[model samples]
Target chain A: MALTASDVTIHFGGVVAVNGMALDVMPGEIVGLIGPNGAGKTTFINCLSGTYRPNTGTALWQGDELIGLSPSALLRKGVARTFQNVASLHDLTVLDIAKLGAGVRRDRRTGGHLLDFFRSDRALEELLMESILAPLELNDVAHKPIQTLSYGRRKAVDLARALAGDPQLLLLDEPVAGLTSHEGMAMAAAVRDVRDRHGCAVIMVEHKMDVVMSTCDRVAVMAAGSKIFEGRPAEVQADPEVRRVYLGEP
Target chain B: MSTRHIAIAIGVAVVMAVLAVVLGRYGAYLVNAVAIAAIGALSLNLLIGYCGQISFAQGALLGVGAYTAGNLGNAGLDGAVAILGAGVLGALVSALIGLPAMRLRGLYFAIATLAAQAILEYLFKILDPLTNGVSGLVIKPPSIFGIPMTSDESLVLPSLVLLVIAWLVVSRLLRTDLGRAFLVVRESEIVAKGMGIDVGHTKLWAFLIGGFIAGMAGALIGFANRLASPEAFTLDLSADYIAMIIIGGLGTWPGPIIGAAFVVLLPEVIQRVGEAAGISDILSALRELAFGLLIILFLIFEPRGLTALLSRIKLRRIGVVPPAGLRATGEGSQSPEGRSR
Candidate 1:
């Protein structure tokens, strides 16, 4: 397993946000986490990404413990995540955000990083546009400020930023939730393409069942604050308890 | 960089050089004052405008530079060495102050800086041995290879050169990853951290860089006036520097220069107007009133500052259409609602 998260748990006031959430993801695999409203799917992903510290649990990525590490530290450890709501920075263009992502990547090949102080990152800018932005159809507005991009495009830019970092474990929160059907499909395809190219493990928290079924190799279903079912997508859809709690079958 | 930006820079440089050569002694002195003020404004902007960190202690940091330069110069150190020492001290002091305070957000940070300003001011007066007990120290004119640059006319070219170098260094830094990291931290520390940026370290860098630049500005001021006085760098001076960036526009490269020139030259213009009208006494009182009123008006009508106003006019003249995203009406101008469909 590239990532093994065991007994991960967190609480907010009296309510449990996540309870004993355990997951294992192999390299180059996509695991979709789906749950109803108030389920702990997003909360579990947050725990793994270092956004929130679980009250008790341990997540090991490549055999290194990830508890108590900061988000930046996680990124340095080759774990990166995309936000559910894309960040629309003032005065920064799409290309600029992607470049920011490129700045944090752990496996930089260059020897003299400080030499970057003297020259413009025009080469990185071009490469990002070609590899990351082009696939998402964001190249057209690459130079436009993120605040000026449409809702769907900004989300794409957020994904572009995450991909630019070349993470070993990618955590995406609703990557295609706000996008059009066509854009959603394209985003799903792009996610798969990135996994194939980078051979990185992925844990995606999503509400859209169609996208998850098509994109995820494995699926986990959550209810309240614990995992209720874990199986292949077809098996998850077929499970009676999952159908009762999540799918709302009579 | 764009050709248009380069053209504008070169044109501005030529105009300033020509003005330096053609102006009389008093005009040259005023120009030197504005140049030094511009450097300070630029430094403040790096924190407040670019990094979104509020600081009310810039004037104190400027004093630190001035005193360092003054003491070193008095000890017979070379001018370059004195200025460099000031920058080093400024960086160290700012980092030390910022380490604890940068964790505070918004108004809390501002208040912390306000406290720093008061503390530094008291130190300047209480540390009598080094600062001469508020009597202040006179700075000798700097020399370059045996040539003394004492007169205002003689110093104008050097001041202009220093301003140009400052501009180049800042602009180049903005083009690098470090600059983008500053912007990310400004936008949201949570997001910045998620993106692998060390928020605390980035904020520290902002303060260090800002203090160093402000210190250099102080050294220039000391060189220009031949004095490093505590009274010259009061809380009011810090407020004025903040107003310069706000009125001139924030985050834009040329905003601070334009703002400093406006702030420094406005009083002289008001005084001259008063003299011409034979009502100098009344105009002196009106100076403060005019400054306040102008700031209010700019905030009301052009909250984005003079840079946005200029850009709007240029965009109109060029007949460029606004982007589709901006054309959306109402709350759509804000980032799309984070709601998932």
Candidate 2:
């Protein structure tokens, strides 16, 4: 398995945000985690990605401990994630954001200061630019600062940045939560395309049923922070417990 | 970056040197004072402009350096060693201040630095043995490499040379990895950390660098005056350094120089007008009032500074259409690609 979380739980004061959540994602697999609003899908992702410390249980990536690491530590260990809120995201071009992701890898071995002369070199930057942006069809606007782009284009840019890190596993927190149906399908196909090209594992946290059902190879359903169902997307669609928790008294 | 840029810089230096020779003593004194201020202002720019740390301790550090230099000079340490000793003292004091104040942010950071200034001034008052306190200390002028530079015209040459050295340090830093990290930290500490930047260490380095430059400037200023006084390193002087960076444009290579020239020359020009009109005190007050108003106006309307405005005008003049993202606002848009994700 590329990544596994066994019996993970998190608490905020007295409230249990995530309770006994178990998940596994294999290499090149696109696994979906879905639930209704406030069901703690993001909290689970945060626990796995080192944004929050799990109160109990273990998170492992290829048998290495994934819990208790800082976000940068996780990033250096070959895991990088994009935030849902995306704070401090001003004035940077598409390439610049991608360069930040590229910066993560550079800082891993060489201290950032020493890498200045080579990091932003034209040839290497162009290569990274092509690999990350061309897949998202963002090559045309690569030089343009992200602020000028449409919401859809900006989302594409964010994805490109994550891809720039050359991550072994991508934990996408609702990659297309508010996108139009066309954009959603494009994003889903792009996710699949990235997996195919890079052979990276994916764990998608999403609420869109159409996206989860169509794109996910395997689906896990959450109800009140615990994994209530896990199987093929078709099994998840028919699970009575998932329906009762998400779709209301079935 | 290119050979052509270096050539042009050398050409400018030659012209400035010729101008100093023609203008004589009074002009040299003006140039010397301005050069020292520029060095101090540029150092502060690294912290305030590039690293986004708002500090008002430049003047206090300057005072520390001057006192150190004055004391050292009196003890027969002489020229270069005395100046170097002063810089070391400034760095040590600055590091001590940064250790606690680094934990504070925003208004708290400002207050902490202000308190540092107050404490330093108090020390200067209470410690009469070392500092001479209220009476201050007067010393002989420096003779560099056994060459006596008694006249203002001769002093200007060395001061200009120091300014050039300060400029080189700033240029080298802006192009280095450490420099880019400084910019990154200023832009977003969170993002910088994610990219494996040690934010605390970076800020400390900034404080040290700024202190070192301010220290050097202080030594020069004290040497020029042939005296070290507590009043010379007041909060107003710190505010003036901040003003220089703001007017020049923060985070740009040329901005600090532009800012230094304006702040240094403004009072002189005002004094000249006052002399012609036979009204000295009113002219001085008018200059102070003008400086205060400019600070307020720039902070409100053109916070990105003179460099940003100049860039916009340059772009318009060149008829190079701004990128769609850059067109909406001069500061760039909020959270752009990162926010959407």
Candidate 3:
């Protein structure tokens, strides 16, 4: 397993946010976490991303303990996440944010210089623009500041920032939320391409059923802070329990 | 980058030099004060404008540098050495202060910096022998490259040169990747951290750079006055520094210069108005009161400072109507195209 979570539990005061959640992500596969509102889907991603510390159990990346690490530390461990509410970076261009992601993977000594002297080593930035951003058809607005982009484009930039880290495992929170239908499919295609090109594990928390069905290799269903089922995307669709919990089927 | 900018800069420099020469001793004194204050104001602008950190301790850092220079000068050190020592000492102390406190945010950090200013001022007062207590220390005129600058006209040339150097350094630094990192930290720590930026370290660096500028300014002021007194580095001085940055435009290079000129000239204008009204003292008091009120007003309405306001006006004149897209959020947003559009 490239990433694994065993009996992870987190509580806010007396209320349980994530309870005894266990998940395993194999290398080079995209896993989907699907749930209703307040189902603790984002909460699980938060624990994995080190935004929230789990009260019990372990989160491991390649058998190294991943719980309680800072976001930057986790980034060093080759894990990265995108935010649902995107950050506002007013002074930088699109390339700047991309460079920031690349900067995370870079050693402090090499990248700390006032200028990017080793720009050749940072081919990932160019690759990201062409492969991920361009295929998402964000080329026309690639030079714009993130704030000037539409909500759909901003979310794409967020994904691009995550990709810049060259992460071994990527955690995405609502990657297609707020996007137009055309943009949503384009983003979904980009996610697939990122996995195809990078061979990285992906754990996505998404509300878009069409995206999950089409993009994810395996689907994990959650309801009220606990995973009810885990199987292939087709099996997940066939499972009556998942259908009842998430789709309101009998 | 533009011919107009170059022309304006050159014109201003010539006018300032001529003013120093043509205007008598009193005018030279005011010009010197403005030049020194502009250096300090620019330093604060780095923190206040670019880094989005408000500091009230710039004047205190300036005081520290001035005292260091004065003491070193009294010990029979050469002018250049004394001035250099003052700046180095001030930067060291400010960097030390930043190391622990840069982790904080908002009003909490501001309060910590203010407290630092208060404590430093007290230290200056308590160290009577070194700082000469509240009595202050008298310094001799500084000599640069065998040229004696004892008189106001002689001092003006050096002051203007230092001001230009300060402006150039600040301008150049803001265009680099390090400058972009400072802005990244200022915008959101979470985003910065996510991008693998050492947010704490970046904040500390900003504080250090700002302090270095303030320290250099302090050295210049000390040389101009040939004295170091506790009264020279008071809370009032700190407030004046804050006022200069706020009025000028905060983050832009020209903001501090304009702010320094306004604050320095406003008092003279008020004195004249006060003389005409036969309430000179009250008029001066009102100016001080107005200075404080202006800070509050800027915070409420135009926190981006005069530069942003002017840019908007210019845009309007060019027949460009800005969309009401992101202005509702107050803070400026960068477009995906990378401009601050």
Candidate 4:
């Protein structure tokens, strides 16, 4: 398994945000986490990404415990995440943000750090333009500051940033939450493409049913901070309790 | 740098050199003042503009450099050794001040720096054996080989050389990964940490680099004035250095130089105008008032400083469109909005 998180539990005041959340994903597989609002899907992703420390948990990535590492530490360990709300940076071009992502990659080319003092970033710029920005269809506005882009384009930039690192385990929080249907479909396709190319495990917390159904190799359902069901997408849709609580079937 | 940037730099250098040779003694003195101020302003800009750390201890730090150089020079050390020694001391003192920066930010961080200034200033007076207290110490003219650099004309070249070195160091550093990390920390520490940068360490580096430059500026000042006095570095001097960077344009490489020249030359220009109009008394009384008003006007009308204003003019002349999302108001464009999720 690429990631095996078990008995992950966290509490905020008296409320248990996530309790006994257990998940396992094989290499190159995409796991869709689907649930109602406040079901701890994002909370679980946050725990795995090191944004929140679960009070009790065993989150092992490739056999290493990821309980107390910082976000940057996790990133260096080949784990990266995208925010639900994309951050709009002033004075920084889309390409610049992508470069920042590429800058932290563990396998960055030799002398990239040292050469930055005396050399232009043209080579890395070209590489990122072709590999990351072009795939996201953000090449046209790559030189423009991120704040100038449309909301959908900004969301794409966020995804591009995460992908630039070529992470082993990608955690996405509502990657398609506010995008149009076309954008959402494109984003889901990109996630699949990333999985195929990098052979990385992905745990995507999303509310879009069609996206989850089409993109995920497996599905997990959560309600009130605990996993209620785990199965194939079709099986998840057919589960009686998932149908009653999440799919709204009588 | 591109060919165009190189050409511009060379052109500026040639103009300054010619001005130094042709201008009378007073002009050379003024140029030296501009150069010294530029060094301090540039260092302060690194902390305030790029790293987003407000430091009010620059004046005290300058005093530290000046006293170190002056006392060492009086003790028969080579001028180069004194200046370098001062720089090393400045970096150490700045790192000490930066310890508190890890726990404070914004106004609180600024207050801590202010306290550092107060403590250092008091130490300068109490450590009378080293600093010579309120009486101050006389500085010997720094010599290169056997030639003494005594006159303003001679000092102008050294001052200009120091300024160029300061500019080159800062500009080069800004292009490096460490510089980019500084910008990230300034924009958002959370994002910086997320990207694997140690925010505290970056801030400390900023302080160290800034203090080193400030120390170099102090050594230059001691060389120019032939004295290292406590009165020369006061809270007001620190405020002026801050004003120079703000009025020039923060974060832009040329901003400090431009701002320093403006701050240094304005008073001399006012004095000249007063003498010519036979109203020296009135103008002397209003000098401080005029300085305050100018800063206010610039802040209100051109908050990005002269650098942004110049760029806007250049863009207009070239008929190029400004970046689309830039806000209409000058002050709004400078705000750190949309920096965080």
DockQ, per model, reads 0.53, 0.31, 0.40, 0.41
Cα distance off (Å), candidate 2, residue B3: 6.7
Question: lDDT for every model?
Answer: 0.81, 0.76, 0.78, 0.81
Say which prediction, candidate 1 or candidate 2, comes out ahead on lDDT.
Answer: 1
**Residue-wise lDDT of candidate 2 within B103-203, one digit each (tens)?**
77656787788889888988877788888888787856777656665666766766677777777666666545466567677777776765545667778
By TM-score, the better pick of 1 and 4 is: 1
Cα lDDT of model 1 by residue, B1-341, tens digit = 34555566566666776776678787788888888888888888888888888889888888988888888877888777777888888888787668665568877888888888888888888887667758887888887445577888877776677777676667666666778888888788888887778787778878888888888888878888788778977888888898888778767778888888899999899899999999999988987677788778776766446765666566567996545333211111222331111
List candidate 1 stretches off by more than 4 Å.
A106-114, B1-7, B318-341
Tell me which residue pairs clash in candidate 1.
none
Kindly list the per-residue Cα lDDT of model 1 for residues A121-195, writing each as its tens digit.
778888999988998889998877788777878888988898888789999998999889888988899899999
* DockQ of candidate model 2: 0.31
Best by TM-score: 1
Given candidate 2, what's the lDDT at residue A165? 80
Give interface RMSD, every candidate, in order: 4.2, 4.6, 3.6, 3.9
Clashes of each: 0, 1, 13, 0
Model 4 agreement with the true structure over B212-288: per-residue lDDT tens digits: 88887887788788887778888878888888887887766678888998888888888889999999889878867
Model 2 docking grade: acceptable
What residue pairs are clashing in model 4?
Answer: none
- Considering just the first chain, candidate 1 attains a TM-score of 0.94
Give candidate 3's iRMS in Å, 1 decimal: 3.6
Candidate topping lDDT:
4
